[model samples]
Target: MAQQKVKRLPDADVEAIFGAFAAAEPEPKGELDYVNPFTLLVAVVLSAQATDAGVNKATKLLFQLADTPKKMVALGPAEIEDKIKTIGLFRNKAKNVFALSQQLIERFDSKVPESREALETLPGVGRKTANVVLNIAFKQPTIAVDTHLFRVANRTGLAPGDNPLKVEQGLLKIVPDQYLLHAHHWLILHGRYICKARKPDCWRCIISEWCRFEPKTPAPKGS
Candidate 1:
């Protein structure tokens, strides 16, 4: 098999590229549906290795039953499991969800913690989940590099690194502070819709001009 060549981008160019992308689609948001920090945390936890569409499907019903820590704990693990049975790792997720809810009630007055360390202390919340909660819920400047963001960052030369943490740190270092709050959502939406995993629709991509990847998808015939 041939080695897949990766694209590289300079800090200034990367900023301009993302800036243009954002200008076109101003105000991007997470696809996952949620009401608050607690619901957002739960949704991100369930979203691991699952599509946003799938996670939203499960949470739509689950949220109705238990939207808050107090309500979630009352719903219990078994019921949570039953409601989210269709999702992957429902058993483990249910256990973590329940444990985290209990932890919230016991430790934080049933409120989602504001700090990263405190948030990560919950059963299922990890660095990525904490980052999402921090960025989306608290309006903090953070980038949560999931697979899509990782690939987009590397392939576009935006903030290339070997791992998600490094990429996230690089993004924080390079991305303009003014755009920090919504940068993650812009990259995620771009990666999901245009620079996809399988066949990136480069022809229609707005950033193709700035991309370092050679031989980008050609414009459709007779367009």
Candidate 2:
């Protein structure tokens, strides 16, 4: 079967779509729960391959016990593993959580570094994780292209790309400066609730008129 080529939204449409998003959600936020930059970093690290609700459920108690690098090191990998056992790949994530905590103490003076390079140096911290921390914790204009973001970006013609990095770059280039800071959260929430993968809720989407996806899913029969 041939792959369908994705259409890219023009700058004006992209701007308008984001403007609508901004208007709808003036102060978007990441769903993951965290008390501070350190906890936020840990939460993002644990969020890989896991849902925000799942991560939050595990981290709620974990963060209360050890929200800082020093406290996390004291809790150790074993306790961390026990707490996050419900999450997928719990063992590996626990190891990373402990290792990253130790690294923070040794290298970063128990502080979460603001730079992407520094954040990526920690265990299990990748581009997506770093982008999340930078944007949510540090208030930087970095977009973390998760599955939801990727799907929405491609489906809406907002920033079609083969991979997350490509999509992130495309969004950085196209999204208006004012919307860049909260664009990640807005798109993530939109994809999760409205622009779903199996059946997008196009009927209710505010940006549906501008979206390039054809054959938009209609409202279910019998209003």
Candidate 3:
């Protein structure tokens, strides 16, 4: 069978969808736990291929021990590995975490850089990760296209694209200026809770009226 074409939402529909999201959640925040910008960077790095809940769980003690670059460097890779062993790719992530800490201490003067280029220079920090750090840490209007955001953007016809970068660019171009800052959180929360991959709870979706997805899934039988 041929793949169905995803229709792009019009300007008015996009505005309405975001407006509904804003009304429902005026200040959407990322689920990641962090003490400061440095901890936020560490959390986002450890969150690669890992769930927010899992990352938060692992980082609870870890952050307490090493919330700063100097502290993380002092903890060393072995300790970091042991702390994050429950997460996937713990070994490599630990190495990246340690290296990034050292880099921040030596190069950035123990500070998390706000620029995307500088952030990406750190180990394990990519475009998506950098975007998250920029948006959450620095309050930049950046859309980090993670799995949830990617699915929601495409499925809802908000910013359809084959890859995350394309979807990110598409969203950056279209999402209204007023809603851009919180748009990332809104889409991510909606995707995680309502517009899920296996089965979206379309009946409860706030912007279902503007969604271009066909045959919306109904709420399970009798509530």
Q: Where's the lowest-lDDT run of ten residues in candidate 3?
A: 1-10
Model 2 lDDT per residue over 24-56, tens place: 989997899999999999888888899989999
TM-score attained by model 3: 0.97
Candidate 3 ranges beyond 4 A from true positions: 1-4
- Candidate 1 lDDT tens digits, 13-129: 877887896789778889999998899999999998888899999999999989999999999899999998889988999999999999999999999999999998999889999
Model 3 lDDT, residue 132, Cα: 93
Query: Candidate 3 on 109-157: residue-level lDDT in tens?
Result: 9999989999999999999999999999899999999888989988889
lDDT of each: 0.87, 0.92, 0.93
- Model 2 residue 131 CA deviation in Å: 0.4
Ordered by lDDT, highest first, the candidates read: 3, 2, 1
Q: In model 1, what lDDT does residue 81 have?
A: 96
Off by over 4 Å in 2: 1-4
Of candidate 1, the 10-residue stretch with the lowest lDDT total is 1-10
Flag the better candidate by lDDT, 1 or 3.
3
Residue 8 displacement in candidate 1 (angstroms): 4.5
For each candidate in turn, the TM-score is 0.94, 0.97, 0.97
Candidate 2 collision pairs = none
